[model samples]
Target: MVNIRRIGLVATLCASVLSLPAYAQQYRFNYSKLYTQMKNNLEEGHPDVKVAFFFQEHKTSRLCKIDKAWMEKDKHYEEFVIPPSQELIVPLDDNLRQVGPLVYVNAEQGKTCDFSMVVMTKQPLSGEVSYQDIEQLLPQMSKMLDDLGGMFSSWFAPKVIGLTFEFDGVKQSAIQTSKGNTFSIDNGKAKVNLADLSKNESLLLPQTTFRVLPLLEK
Candidate 1:
């Protein structure tokens, strides 16, 4: 006969393990060397441009009501900025980026504030670089990976969800899933693809900058 208590125990363990966050996986990559390569690429191409990195903080009005008077008095927004910096490692999953210096805000009440990184250039890129441009750059990134040897890939294959580029304050973004190399871009203003760009692990900055976001308690 099957032991009911043992089956229950097994079920509980499986549920607990499944509930953990996907970002909990220790996704390690060569942050330092990647940063160096990114810096070099930007300097050689856009010499005058600066890059800024930031994540959005989203909070709901119901949560704000806990401190209604104070939130109202402060005139906070539901969405706000967590600026960029060289030290920032762009989180593979947007939600996982919320390691904070959180601030309270009152923007977009009653809705969840979805946070994601915004990679911006101080000045617009000289011209639009499309998938073809990225394709050309692939060899450069592949070469960098090759130099790292097989050890890098043997451990894990890095996955990139997406990347957003801002040109003269206009936004263009691309998204990809773990299943394939195809990606979709928004606004159609930029022709870049995340799959091609993700190949270059070293592309990390143009002169990356950062800002801190505020926290709200529920």
Candidate 2:
């Protein structure tokens, strides 16, 4: 009787494990697809702008720069630079496969390069997703994931906690949001809480340039 109960319990556990949702496993970072979307968006949205995409180590206090050696290593580009002049598409190699790189959109001197950025991450959130402002968009984002699956969902599936924008070209950075609120990027970087920009749905606008740093789980 006891042996029979043990076997039954093992069978039940196996069933439960097998019944788990496969959606989570399906979620992935497809760099080619992501780059295509970003490229097309930038081309159609802002024809005069050029952008660079790279991963910045969070713990590094100093500014991040793309290394020439790494960029040219193995004939595989680690950093991607997209120019509006031509259709430039560089494939992401295995080294930075699943990492979400920071995007730098450039603007002509004294001009603002306005654009929208999608936050993507595969890591789990560090804490609870309780931001009331972003909470409202959860349902819509979920629907997007269901419809688009991993192709585009990676852009919006992650929970955004804090946002950081860094501007390097000009000394004084005048950053503005879609809500009309303005902020300055000190020392080429400015950290902003998502709660503060509740009314804004997008980041990056004219008269300044910046890089995006979205808070992720430690």
Q: Give per-candidate clash totals.
A: 18, 2
Per-residue C-alpha lDDT of model 2 across residues 10-60, encoded as one tens digit per residue:
001111011113211111123534453344323232222223233222344
User: What's the TM-score of each model vs. the native?
Assistant: 0.24, 0.31
Which regions in candidate 2 have their CA more than 4 angstroms from the true location?
1-60, 64-67, 70-90, 93-159, 171-182, 198-208, 216-218
| Cα lDDT of model 1 by residue, 1-218, tens digit | 11111001000111111111331211112323224223433434333322222112244211111111110113432322222222222223223223221222222233332222222233332333344433443333333222222345423423222233322223344333233333333333223334544432322222221211111111
Q: Which runs in model 1 stand beyond 4 Å of their true positions?
A: 1-102, 118-123, 126-218
Q: Tell me how far candidate 1 lies from the true structure as C-alpha RMSD in angstroms.
A: 16.9
Give the Cα RMSD of candidate 2. Answer: 17.9
lDDT of 1 at 196: 47
Alpha-carbon error at 21 in model 1, in Å? Answer: 30
